[model samples]
Target chain A: MSTAPNRTGAVADGGPGRAPARAARPAPTPARRALRRARTWLPGLLLVSPSILLIGVFVYGMIGWNTNLALSDKHAPIQEGEFVGLANFIALWQEARWPAAVGNAVVFTVVFVGGALFLGWLLGLLLDKGIRGEPVFRTLFLAPMAVSFIATGVVWRWLMNPAPAERATGLNALFVRFNLDFLVNDWWTAPDFGMAAMALPAIWQLAGYIMALFLAGFRGVPEELREAARVDGCSEWGVYRHVVMPQLRPVLLSAVIILGHMSLKVFDLIIAIAGQQIIADVPAVYMWAMVFEVRDPAKGATIASYLLFAVALFVIPYLVWTVRKERSEGR
Target chain B: MSVQSASGRVTAPGGRAAGTTRRGQTVKFVVLLALAVLFLLPMYVLLVTGFKPFAEATAARAWSLPQTWSGEGWAAAWEALSSGLRNSLMVAVPSAVVSAVLGSMNGFVMARWRFPGADTVFTLFLFGMFIPYQAVMIPLQQMLVGAGLMGGLFPLILAHTVYGIPICTLIFRNYYASIPQTLIEAARVDGAGMLRTYASVVLPVSAPAFAVTLIWQFTSAWNDFLFAVFLTGPNSWPVTVQLNNVAGSMVVPYNQQMAAAVLASLPTLVVYLLLGRYFMRGLMAGALKG
Candidate 1:
């Protein structure tokens, strides 16, 4: 039955049609060839034009509008204000709250991003080694990635309750039970070190994802490379250290980039865990407060722009790299 | 892909089966397994606390299994969140489907029949994937609200789809890129037009990729709190926002909050458990390509 169509089609189209068709040739006139060539782009553009137009207006246009808002002295949406270049920016320098939030973000990003990458890489190393119940362990480790940061924060909030004496709750209670009472401290409120504690839930939420990435990276290293290394008399740890670990640099880079952007723009997790307090404020949390709660739209826009620029610092390079890679690879 | 001994105390594992009995293999597994359990402990607390009555929930040991279990907390959670759950589905499902369709078209075109500036257009769409929602929130809200679309699911659906375009395009483009150009050429060689060729030749093979993109978008939309909080008012609150509200109740609805958290997480959790491989593939694709 399948051969019937092939048999018939082969017999029927056995003419000059095959040659011209293969050549993508047409009426043998330059005008017609030009039209044919031009027609090829129409469907492709027609297919994607809607997305390009909408995304242009929505994402890029919004970003441009946001920058304009940042440059103005507007405090509320739909309100017109004079062009006040860098006024909000100057004000932010004097505002203790903004810089405090920036500090918190820096601290949070360093600890959370570093911790997650290290922990995820370590787990990947273990899982990369052949082990029983591999999928089971993988699933268990990666389960948290499924849940929202909001939910994860809600639970971690309860866990990190900072109480003194025998009345401790959550994790502090465990320290009390085990007589490691010195370890009990106010998490996310522990002054200077609170951001570190505040970063725990974020780490918990993302470490598994980083692990999965690194695990994939680990598995991707061809077995033949490891075998070749072994034949050259490299020990197990030596092989991993010299061969596998070196090859995982890209995975490590990706994890850091992903985690870094996440930490910079972190909002819901902090709000979920600690509410909108200054102690736990990141730039994102502060931006929300300024815009909605404080009703200072100019400051909010400025903060958002700053955060956007900061994130662009981490992201634009990567985007350019992707474009370059794709262009160079010709696909 | 693991090799276990008869007593289940064995060595060697995944990606490479049947290797050696390293000296500390058992110890390593025990530590790794223990860490895995600890990583999962918060959910355990979430479940245990949700099951217990309020009194035990607040006063009893946090880790203990519920002494006296009841569905009261769960009922209260359901009461609080049922409307929000419906809203989440209403917002997420349509947005997911719309984005997937849009992405499929965009991808097929970009991969199969690109023209001058096509890469530039594709790159523009790709940039949307990295724009943190915070950067555009103020103007976005203004734009959406100016058009009388605020305080409802429409704005949220629009926001998610617009934001979703980049990722959806990336995934779909990568998927479509794998299909040989010969297939499309063959379709063209036949009497089929562009849309007909897509419907007949390309769309038929798009099921698995659709599953990947749909699940990714749906889970992301389901888990979103920032957009839901900012764009929509209380009338169209999603489950994540509701969970936060319930957690902040003055009387402290801890048990019900836990239950609500579990309820909120269930959809994506089920997706991850059942189609986890696809989910991971989506994640890897986004990361690797970007």
Candidate 2:
């Protein structure tokens, strides 16, 4: 553990992209040098070997195993079925529930991500105004983040109760008390807007986190840059629009990637809010029902693989770009 | 334009401009206050409803204070959730400790030791964070069941520890990078080998990193429902799964369900309330640094 990081730091002083070549150069005494090098590398390698082994078997190996299951005819958890290539994927693609779940996922992602970003950005701006009692407000905003989605779901399920007219309760009841009859509609039960409505609690839970991210981004904007923008005949709005917002693009990208992948893999929140309802079904919920409830590992694995594919489409690239950017910056 | 103000907003020079700024600040405050209240509405409901009797906790009276407050719900919730809470603690504590230890070692190596292709190894570890847990669910179960470790909190603990390594490593790595290189160099000059240096030098100053990773892992493992449901049966269901079952049951009153939610959430809430700064640090490290 010690030698790996220590050696990296030693090489980093020279420059990025220079370590491999320098280390590859011919040594004066091959045997002694090799012995010393191995001594340096072995401890660090040994230190991280357990983690590498676990991640290797659990993450990468599982993906391969899941893919194998998706290709085979495994219906029961214990039973290993014969090889049946692409049948599960084809079957999943043909299922009406899969498409509905996908659609709901899209809607959920759209509202959850968009709402969280906007609300969090707004809160960030509000807190950035030099207000008093900042910590108190910040605490209030971020408290929801500490709560489990199951707990949040339990409370919100009541809050968004779908009963109508004389039987209304929760938010709907509150709306009626205020004579806002038009607003007293079914939440997360309305056919078209169910998933969108579910985003409310999600936004409530996560927006504070986004707010923290944006606030950091906002604070990290050097005062000199804002001063420079202002001196260039820019108004306050202009300072933000041209100077500050651009600097926050990376923060925004990070937030989007984080929230986006989460939205795709959403399971606990939806299940907690509404127990695997078809109207609000997401791929995760479908995958759960398929594997655990329905006992069809093949179909479940297929859905999971698709979800992985969808997530990897964005996450892998973002991760690569981030690493490459850091490397280019010579960090 | 006083430098003493916490935020970056500059006050205008003129009194009139200052008055406008003050007014704007008031408006901002009111808007923030209103939003804060709105955000906290569900929490208020949870508390109030949990204190109410079943009849008073109905949706129509959800906004009303209970005429006759009772601990019946709280008592019942405690009865239903006490075991699950214990289970959660059992799973979360070990998971947090093990992950923190492993992550510290991995992070120490990644950040300070320096190896060829270390960045590649780090990136591979990071990719594990984004993969849907579903992808690993089936195989992990098979492996555990085959090994006869499928039941109880063991599988859940094992899963949390393995899955947590990536984020914990990321947090610890970023943290260790910020430590001065001279310190490590000084330790090395004392003729301390890698393990000894880490144990005596790096580990001492790692409290903040440890705190962040521990709080993060604990909260995640505690809040986790997916793995808890899959890996553990009724006897070992964590607070989350138990809360779900309690809330989902038709016979359970709304008050008990709300009470159960509160009970289930209390530990993480307390942790956040106490160590929120470190939690936010962990949050920022995960999002921004990565």
Candidate 3:
């Protein structure tokens, strides 16, 4: 058995001279090395191929296709598309509703993002103070984060409904108690207050998520620094302003960016609360009207393309910031 | 761990000391309790409404308890919303599993292998993360129509899988990067192939990351409404769509809608609670610091 070819080769390979001599017999050519490298990378490429392929085809490719569609005059049952360059964009700009939608989106983004961040940070600060029943409070606050936007929207829509006879507890009753029947009627009818009503449910649903993010950030802040500030006779607010706030800036920005992105794409909550018949300030609702209600795919596509542009405006800055940060972090 | 003495009283440096901190603690506790109640009001209202009869639910003081307890709302909602829940599960579960598996594999390869276009490919996927869903919605719908897969679960699943990839990949890649390379080198030295290394060594240590990914993806897919509305018909609609329909319609029973909302939201809430600790850690572990 020892003298068999494999056994003998193994035994012989253990001897230094024989092993070196065998190893020195040949070195692969550059072409062969290249082929070996390709062999090693093949499995990895194969593993990632599906995700890459799907993203390439659907996300990037469709974006280009939509941009093209936005430029054309193609309506329902799109024919051989005529290159009616910029006509759709001009029409989109000229529409009374489009500007309203843009304004609504901007206002919604600012209010939702800013308000959520502020309230979230405050809650996080309270939680960080070694409050008792920490887990219970944390869970209670975070429950809304777990609730589906669908549920939030539905519940809020019910709350916001104008029927005085149907006005229940929660914000509706509170508004009524305060002589603010405007919540049920004038809030949705008055253009100025209508947007606020639409935004209320969204803010309620999202504030918890923002709080969670801030809680995470608060956890990351070292206790020693906080203690040092306190020892120096810093007021609670001063400690937060100086020691905590500086460290929390990045997390705050990230949360804002994420919330901002979501707000730009917001549709369901608005639709659920106001229904399609009432609120016309949101571009997404308008787009839905154009596509599903009116069955004008071309106009719908154009409207959707405008929304896409809005999303890009919010997302691109965050993406660039993220990438730059990642690179700087040497990842 | 040092207990520093303050004003002749010893207390943990950053800790909220007992007796000495009573006033501060009480104030904080009261504030927190008040906030918690306010925070939970909507859910309380939802639960109350769900348990009431339709008539009571629609009454002026709908938040008040019904004259009699009833299961009619639950039964009605369960009957009406069952199909929607089923549709949601079908789309969400498959999308989650596929996205997690594919994303983890992509992360593994990207972290371990140095390929020519790896950086560019990874960057491109990140680009998808930034592109708003609205931006791609129209084109994606058209493309699905072109492929004859629109108004079906398949398109929604495909769309979700694509949408989920960027975040999933980002998560797993960041996770795998933190894993020491020596493990991989050791596996290689032991004559373990790529699959053997991942299956035997890499994945075992990756349970926390996988758990987080699974929960996150599951909840996200389960809750998604935008794509569900566009990509599927009423027969294939998810709970979100049904919820929307019920909520949007004028004659919808408030009690039934509330019951349905609770039922629709329960599973994700349960999952979040069960994995709360791991989920928070996973969220923190991501590239959040920068």
Candidate 4:
């Protein structure tokens, strides 16, 4: 690590790029110089090798093994099973619970991401308005990002207590108090929409962080553009719509990618709120139930492999974009 | 007269805009304030309920203020979650520190050193960030069992540290990119090698990045539920798992559950509230970068 960083620093500082090659060059012993060059690379290699090994075994190696397990029918925990050739994947199509979980995942991801992005953008715009007590409001919005979903879930579960009408506590209790009886429902207890209800706290926990992301994005737009737009007789609304929103396209994409992957793989929030129930099941929760509760590793691995596919749908494109951006920048 | 201002009622755009904006500002303030209350209501409920007696908590309106402050709930929760809190701290601290150091090294090599396939190596590490924990848990646990490291805090720490590498590396890589290459070159000119320059120059200059990465790692590791549930059983459960268990206890007391929730959230909440600026910086510099 030491020698390699130094050599790069030396090359950057005095060699190759910024200046022309010197006319006078001294010839060194070829073999010795080659050995010296390799020696310089040792520390950097040594420094980075451990992380490479760890990530290799823990991340990629495990992922490869999961893909392998998905292709097999390994029911027993310790006992190895034979390859089944996409049987598990086919079996997933026939499972009622699998499809229900997939549907719930769709609702939850869309609502949660949409909710967070919308709320985040509103809050971000509000913050950009430079109102009084900005710091106080900003803190209130952003603080929940630090909270655990389990904690959020526990509180929301109580808050969303599905007690009917006047007997309600949590959110319903407020409706009863305010005579907004029509507004109250059996949140998370109503059939078919509990997972959607569960997305409330998920949104609550994340929206502020999303807001912070958008606020950062909003702040990145040049002030001069907004002023110039205003000077040209544009309203504040027009300035934001044209000058600001267009500039925030990348931020919007980033938010979607980040929030998209998060929602796809969300496990703790559902498990914490509903405890692997049939109604609110997402793949992560279902996968856990299959592996641990049912001891059906084959099905579990299949679900997991699908989850990986879902994550890759968002991440692979992102990784490609980022890597290409870095490569272009490097050149 | 020259500007025709006194000839008739005239409105300068800036003056009228400010007047309209002032009114709009109040509307925005009220809307935002109301939302803030809505946002803080549950947290407020969690806080005050922790101080309410179980009887009042069960009988009174959930939104009502505590009639009399009490510590019984906290006492009960502390009894339940103290060990989990300890275990979480045990898992989080070492994992965060180790990952931060490792990330700095990896990032340094990647950002500063121009080696063959370094970008590929980095992208490989970055891939670690995106893979779902659920996708890896079965093999991870099986491998842990095979290594005889299963059923302990070690697995939890190792999992967090290993998973932490990608984000931590990204943060450091981004951070180190901003550092003047001339600083490294200056050290090189002084006959300092990588370790020497990094030790004396880079390490000191990296305090901000370290704070960001450390805070990020600690918060994520603390809030982690899936790993704690899968990697470690009840004995080594982090506060999140234990808090869940506490909430799910057979004779569920609302006050006690609220207390446990508060306790479970306190570590990250305090860190966030106190070092909030750093927390935001970390989020921006890492995963939430838009």
Best by lDDT: 2
DockQ of each: 0.49, 0.50, 0.46, 0.45
The reply for model 4, stretches above 4 Å from the true place, is A1-25, A28-42, B1-20, B288-290
TM-score of each: 0.93, 0.93, 0.88, 0.92
Candidate 4 steric clashes: 4
lDDT of 2 by residue, A1-331 (tens): 3343434322323332444565556654767666566666677778899999999999999999999989998888778688999888888778789988999999999999999999999999887645678889899898998989999999999999999969998998888999999999889999979999999999999999999999888878877787787688887678778988999999999999989999999999998999978888999999899877898888888998999999999999898999888767755
lDDT per residue (tens digit) for residues A1-331 in model 4: 3234524322222322322332234564777556556555666777899999999999999988888888987887767789999999988989688898899999999998999999988998777746668789989888888989889988888888887775678888888788899989988867867777878998898888878888777777766777788888888799888888999887888788888888999888887788867778889999998878898877888999999998888788788787777667662
What ordering of candidates by DockQ runs from best to worst?
2, 1, 3, 4
Clash count in backbone of candidate 1: 4
Better of 2 and 4 by DockQ: 2
Q: For model 1, what is the alpha-carbon lDDT of residue B151?
A: 76
Instruction: Fill in the DockQ of model 2.
Output: 0.50
TM-score of 1: 0.93
* lDDT, residue A301, candidate 1: 87
After superposing candidate 3, which stretches have Cα over 4 Å from the reference?
Answer: A1-42, A164-170, A174-185, A231-233, A278-280, B1-21, B281-290
Give the C-alpha miss distance for residue A92 in model 3, angstroms.
1.3
lDDT string, candidate 1, B1-290, tens digits:
13323324443443353233544567778989899878978988899999988877764477778889978889999999999999999989999999999999998877776656777787777778877789899888887778887877999999889899888888888898888877876766665556776788899999988988899999999999999888989999999999888886657667888898999999999999999988887887678542
- Which CAPRI level is candidate 4? acceptable
In the range B1-290, model 2's lDDT, one tens digit per residue, is 33223233433222112112545677888999999889979988989999998778776687998899899999999999999999999999999999999999999888887566778889999999888899999888888989999777899999999999999999888888877888877665555567877888899999999999999999999999989888999999999999999999989999999999999999999999999999998888778463
Q: Write the per-residue lDDT of candidate 1 for residues A1-331, one digit (tens) a residue.
A: 1111222122122232443344543335667645555555666677788898989888888889889888998877557877999888888979788889899999999999989988888888888766778789889888898899999988998889887756888888877778899999999888969999988998888888988998888788888888788788887788889998899887777788889888889999998988887798888988888878788778888998998888888787777787767777766
Tell me how many clashing residue pairs each candidate has.
Answer: 4, 12, 0, 4
